[model samples]
Target: MLSAVYKSLKKIDTYLFIEQRDDFSKVPEPLLAMFGTAELVTVLNLSTKDRLGIADINKVRAELAEKGFYLQIPPPPENLLKEHLAKLKEQGKLSEKYNK
Candidate 1:
């Protein structure tokens, strides 16, 4: 099925997908408000795609079929410092004062 994809102006990497182009009626008001203005990204043919860059194709299709819309939010930012600390601890390099 063909789906219209829109990028959220207010949130980076956030997208909204709907079955029909220019149709936001299926999307709720609170979600729309949070999404802010939307800019059309592309019209994707889900039938042709087995997977998407970030979102799961099956989940997107299921949500579209059940709710008429699908929302894609960015993944949480990586905690590099926390990861580094864990790595250091694993390597037995982290000081006891810092490990606590």
Candidate 2:
């Protein structure tokens, strides 16, 4: 299936994929307001792609077929401190002072 991809100007690394080019009829008004202006990134033939860079291809196809659009948002930022603490705990290197 052919899909049009658009990048949001207000959101970093956020994209909207629609089944048809220049069609936002299925998208919600509030979502569009928050997304700001959308710039067309590219048109893709999903049938030719085995996987996408971020989104799961099967999920994307399902959403597009059911909801007429698929929204791709950036993954949450990593918490370095939490990860370090977990690693330290796993390695038995976390001191009582550090825990406090």
Top candidate (TM-score):
1
What residue pairs are clashing in model 2?
A: none
Residues forming the 10-long window of minimal summed lDDT in candidate 2: 91-100
Scored by lDDT, model 1 comes in at 0.98
lDDT (C-alpha, whole model) for all candidates = 0.98, 0.96
Off by over 4 Å in 1: none
Off by over 4 Å in 2: none
lDDT of 1 by residue, 1-100 (tens): 9999999999999999999999999999999999999999999999999899999999999999999999999999999999999999999999999997
TM-score for each prediction? Answer: 0.96, 0.93
